[model samples]
Target: MTDEPQRAGRRTRLYALTDGRTAAPHTVLTMDTTITAAVDAHDGLPSEWRAVLAMCPAPNGRAVAEIAARMRMRLTPMALLLGELADRGLIHHRPPLEGAETTNVHLLMRIRDNLARI
Candidate 1:
């Protein structure tokens, strides 16, 4: 039988690899963010994170969803791992592009006006 720490370590490793599907399916990873070589060299980095960094092409990096899918990990854990990497300055988490979140209020108003004109 394995010791408690060993069992916990195994669990972590398993969690790091498998997608338990507990997180929101729509959880979006910042597509524009880039992980760096520093992350690759960081000895303290978790294997799951390191795997993500390795999979990332750098400069262009990848979407959070893409990275999570590639890594076969859950969305929340992937986000947390990316946050950890950013905290360590081993990666850059670029916020979603401005104006990308424009609401449809303008469209709705235009539609309402057009309907009134009918």
Candidate 2:
């Protein structure tokens, strides 16, 4: 009942945000890809875009999955928004390191151990 309207509205908003595009032009982005705000001034940009930029500060960036979770947005659409921003030079993206799964296993193990301590 009430859920119907909310879902419809969310669909409408997502369509508007991505301009009805189901896929991003550049498909290199992955869940672990890092995103950073390239420009400090986002004046005149849409609220959604501004929000995404606000989440990603320079230097230490946020992972694609983290941003999507934080914004309550689906990964595909978030990737679309990020692709548009990157096209406009408003943001920068770095794909995950090659062989991250194999290379970062040690790091992941350490983090897991630390979490178990808490």
Candidate 3:
């Protein structure tokens, strides 16, 4: 009555998907980083990479955490894949806003309340 088997399988799959790379190279992406597709075509790419590209269209973008959730992937592996795509000019991202830690909590609460009322 444990999920260990499933967890192991998922871990193995992620390892393969990332080609055993534990970290992204030359790129620093945070959970809130906004990702967007930079290329129109995804021919000859791996299915996971294609999935990532498909999830990210142009203009409006998705947050790294959102993409990881939608794709059922861990943040680190997703970031690694995204970093590779960015290196190849297949995608681009905007890091989380600087100084977000100092943002006004009251304003955020108001926004949350407004959203709840909608």
Candidate 1 worst ten-residue window by lDDT: 1-10
Tell me how candidate 2 scores on lDDT: 0.72
Instruction: Give TM per candidate.
Output: 0.49, 0.69, 0.66
Clashing pairs in 1: 29-64
Mind giving the per-residue lDDT tens digits that candidate 3 earns over 4-50? 11222323366575667666677888888989988764567666677
Candidates 1 and 2 compared by lDDT, better number:
2
Going through the candidates in order, what is the number of backbone clashes in each? 1, 0, 0
TM-score of 3: 0.66
Global lDDT scores for all candidate models: 0.52, 0.72, 0.71
Which residue ranges in model 3 land beyond 4 Å of their true spot?
A: 1-20, 98-118
Task: List the candidate 2 regions with Cα displacement exceeding 4 Å.
Answer: 1-12, 100-118
